[model samples]
Target: MTPARQKLLIVTRHTPLPWEDGAGAYLHDLARYLATDGFRVHILWLAPHDRLRWKKIWRLPAPFARAVRLHLPGALRLGRRFVFLAVVWLPFKARALDRVRRALNTVGLAPPRRHPSPAPPAAAPLWASPPTPAELALVVRFFEKHRPDVVITNYAWLCPILDLPALRRTCTACLTHDIGWQRAALSAPGIAPEITRDGEAAWLRRAALLVAISETDAAELAALAPAARVVVAPKACETRAPFAETTSRSLLFVGSDNAFNARGLDWFLREVWPRLLREVPDVSLHVCGSIDRLVTLCPDGVAFHGPVPDLAPCYRQAALVIVPLLQSTGLNIKLVEAAACGRAIVTTPAALPGAPFLRDAVAVAATPGEFAAAIRHLLDQPAVRAATAARALAAVRARLAPATCYGPLAALLRANAVARHDVARDLRVLHASGAHPPQP
Candidate 1:
């Protein structure tokens, strides 16, 4: 008889949407890839239901919104203490409210406020959370019911799932996108690096395997978790055939509104962009992604195209992509995406860790003057830009393809399942023979 396909459970902090952010896109691609590899993949996403629900509630009136915003955090904290009781209490209230809502609808007094789903690429059944004891019990029960052969946690933040007793016998892995402590240290002031590192390491020790997005991150994780098996599995990008050249003289910078992106964009606008404008007055910089809310100032020659539904047009029309990140950890997904689109790039040393193969392929500039000069050169010389873009595309095709990049991770998961099964069998044998198992 043919053996049954192994089941893989992925637990993440949020349901990944393709258009949302880098993490979402990465997870979406990974899920699809894993599914194609014959694993019955399921996702357990810990959605922030409380936050979303509160946001919806607050949007009723301006005064009510402000009041709720001020008290929401404290209310949540207090609610957590009595969450079990609230679970019992809220359902009855919810039923009554639903009845009233239905009555209103029957009378044609109120319109429905429901919206359609965002329709994620890999649409796995989701389990959202305010993370109550009851909710955790449901999660534990789900794991018990499915008994997945491999359980992979997407981010370091979701590492707490390791504490579940149901997962004790499962082959568990953690896919660390970056060094969490390093990014946390940069973003949060007054927090010691050692403290954050220790906390992350403690949770990571529970995993059978740890997958880092880059070699640099793998090395760091190895140092922190000396006994844990850590490996590098770089972010994969969908390779595209090189498109025909366009005469669009615009530079593109695409990133979500995060601390690293904000800091980098602010610095670039303040330093590099002005110099580039001086050199090529006709050249314009088009900003894309969730950056509009973060950026307060909009200078001339800068177009903020907030969160485009499609980045293909942006990439195709752009002369080159700029990643002037001053503080970042892990692989830069945007850089990979840009290269995959066959666009030339000018980026800082900090953003080069993820795509080191592209060092010679794309322009690398640190200082504002160097960045401006590189952009100017690329704009003035289309042949040079095309050559650089071709090299970058070649590197991505060879290195960052989904199959090439994520294959190791798939192999590791398979190995972990075999190892786990052997250990369980050995334990059963030992128990039958009345022999005590050896301690770790």
Candidate 2:
């Protein structure tokens, strides 16, 4: 007899083709691992018409570079400046303005786009910036046809249960990257309640399992959807990647243009960055990312390298990695990447949680003054910086290994409906055949 094939349909915000941003990288790694594990996989993601031509790029090394560029804030800072200039300088042609706005929206800036969004006549939309009916319908049909044994989606925004009702019957799992509704509520007031009502909250309640990257996040999910299954799926860094270090170094900060990251950078630049630059005049601050709202007009020593294929080189040369996040609810992947690169990290206590870093294990600082003072202190002491980097690397290796992080995820997912049915059927036959004897 032949063995049955195990099929999985992964519905994500972006197709898991290449490593781009956090969510895109998540899907990419999942698909690659699952495919290697002998599961038949179908990926569903949103891609612009322009990106369709480069579909093959997802399988190539170049896309990995694109992913880095997309996530880095420095590069994005430049783009925002141009957009700001366009908003002010460009003619107010409504149709042209709409096109520009849509294009900008797709870019995913930290701050909201300037132009008005095109929406059909309704009292209020389902989401803050809801997907179109056409987009949701396409997702529904794609999942239905695939008829996967397991259906995994990102979060409630892209995978509302009401929109894709068929997914309820399937073994559904969602990787809660961050509580979008929570972040919206925190960053943009009064927006969360509306988006949550449109089915985001209910979808979480119905999900077979919800995976949060941190304990802080899992707790938040519990508050929102009390009855749902939620698990903390910690984030990890890629341990092996090669690069060379340069002698002249500066403090490095990298993140995509999200309101959370932007807030962090704004604080750093406003409070911490100026002080650090003043102390170390020649020390260059390299801001590498796509979103450019904050990093534009960076000072003399501050060079904004829009985006790079590999951050390993930057990490190698960097004296310290700064994660100055004020408002966020999950593990910072950029910090993980820094650890994997063996760079000393200076971040607010809020940016890093449950890392065992505060008890002199790995992390430092809780305020801008302390953060700036720490960066300056580390720069003055080469030995301390080197030692800290070594310890940080060891901490990452021991705790944040990809295998260590994904192990819990795999176990939880395997216990879902599809895996349970498969296990039950096998056990039933074994019991019926009296293959097991009574224990003494």
**Candidate No. with top TM-score:** 1
What residue runs in model 1 are displaced by over 4 Å at the alpha carbon? 1-3, 48-135, 189-195, 422-440
Tell me the alpha-carbon RMSD of every candidate. Answer: 10.7, 11.2
Model 2 agreement with the true structure over 209-323: per-residue lDDT tens digits = 7878777788878877777788776666667742333355687878765777777777877887777777767676777775364455565677667546567678877888888
Per-residue error for 131 in candidate 2, Å, reads 5.1
The C-alpha lDDT values of all candidates are 0.76, 0.63
Q: What lDDT score is found at residue 113 in candidate 1? A: 76
Q: Candidate 1: TM-score?
A: 0.78
* TM-score per candidate: 0.78, 0.72
lDDT of 1 by residue, 1-440 (tens): 11256788877665354455777677767776777776777766444335334343322233222211111221233321212234455778889889989999899899567777888654422331123454456568768877888888877656667778888777888888888888878876686553377788887887778988888888999987888899787878887676666688899999887889999999999998888888899988899988777876778899998877578989988989999999888899999899999999999998887778988898999999999999999989999999999999999898988888888788788778867877878899999999999988
